[model samples]
Target: MEDNIRNSDRAPLPVGLYPHARKVGGLLFLSGVGPRKKDSKNIPGVELNDKGEIVSYDIETQCKSVFENVRMILEDCGSSWDKLVDVQVFLTNMKDDFSTFNKVYADYFKDIQPCRTTVEINALPTPIAIELKCVAEVSS
Candidate 1:
């Protein structure tokens, strides 16, 4: 399809109404993905307190889960991890999580080396620690 909206069964369901990714020309633009899995509200690596506030989270776990979500969307759109051209990362606490996030990121992207930006945010729609927005070249 020249233009397509894609969603992957293997990936977590999006938090909003948006599709997982959209394709135009030879590129796929992935929506921001978080650590929450399909049909589950519990975020991986996140521990919530009794009042429903975040107590603790594992950045590495969130990073890995987000990467897997992105990969699944890319593949669903006929693309692959190596085809990623850019990634935008959002963290609830950059200062606390950056180091761990970077280490985990390197494990997955050391060779692919897609352009990336990490920013600190106050919060996400859900009680997750990290989210990723990605773009990749779609293979023909």
Candidate 2:
């Protein structure tokens, strides 16, 4: 069974053609969530050119925002940080950002400690430095 949580104000709305989160088979799968705020086009740590390429970025700031967004989504969906089982992090510049990203991530997940996979990517749909997608057990 699948249930879509699309009307959530806790997390930012989907930035593209997708729902914020969907519960299927007792697990909540979240879309790739960026650091952009709801109802706005600004990315917290991103400085972009007119062409949408990165001019500069602050990975630590982006990491904090992304995790907070994910946390809010879980709360709104009746879950919590401890319920998260996995996370996938996509970084535009792992070489430069990984250490900062990792530090900020530890600050969030050091206790809950979800399994995570971090990967380097060329870019995301937005001009942000990082994006996070995760899965968690759906609480009753």
Candidate 3:
């Protein structure tokens, strides 16, 4: 069976129309998660204009917040951090933000390291600096 976690009170709502996480077979797929606060428009480490264009950002802070969102989703879905198998990271400025974001990422996954790929992009749907889309194995 396939299941979707949408608009979950345990995690921040996705900025776009999408599920926070979806389970198919024995794996869970998380959507590209940004650092937006739950039930609020504020984004950590991001300065947005009235039109929601990014003005400035701190990658480390944003990365931490994104992981926190992922953590919440994992917990609610009967999974754990160590279950993560892969992660895809999106950064607006790889040359400038990669190191800081990597450090923050290592702090969380120090031992349970998940395979990761990072890429730089010109923009995201929101004014955030980073997004994390990942897959995890679920113990059924």
Q: What lDDT score belongs to each candidate, Candidate 1 first?
A: 0.89, 0.83, 0.83
Error of 2 at 129 (Å): 1.3
Pairs clashing within candidate 2: none
Per-model tally of clashing residue pairs: 0, 0, 0
In model 3, what is the error at residue 88, expressed in angstroms?
0.5
RMSD of 1: 1.6
Q: Tell me which of candidates 1 and 2 scores higher on lDDT.
A: 1
Q: Model 1: per-residue lDDT, tens digit, 1-140? A: 53588889988887678989888888999999998877787888999998888898888888888888888889887899999999999999988889999889999999999999989999899888899999999965
Q: Which lDDT value does model 3 have at 32?
A: 85
Candidates 1 and 3 compared by lDDT, better number: 1
Instruction: Tell me the spans in candidate 2 whose CA falls farther than 4 Å from its real position.
Output: 1-7
- Provide the RMSD of all predictions against the true structure, rounded to 1 decimal: 1.6, 1.6, 1.7
lDDT of 3 by residue, 6-73 (tens): 33577777766778788877888888888988888888888877787777888888888899998888
**With candidate 2 superimposed using the best TM-score fit, by how many Å does residue 87's alpha carbon deviate from the native?**
0.5
- TM per candidate comes to 0.94, 0.91, 0.91
At residue 9, candidate 2 shows an lDDT of: 87
Best by TM-score: 1
lDDT of 2 by residue, 14-129 (tens): 86677778877678888898888877778888798989788888888888889888888888876777899999999989998898888888888898888999999987877888
Error of 2 at 139 (Å): 1.6
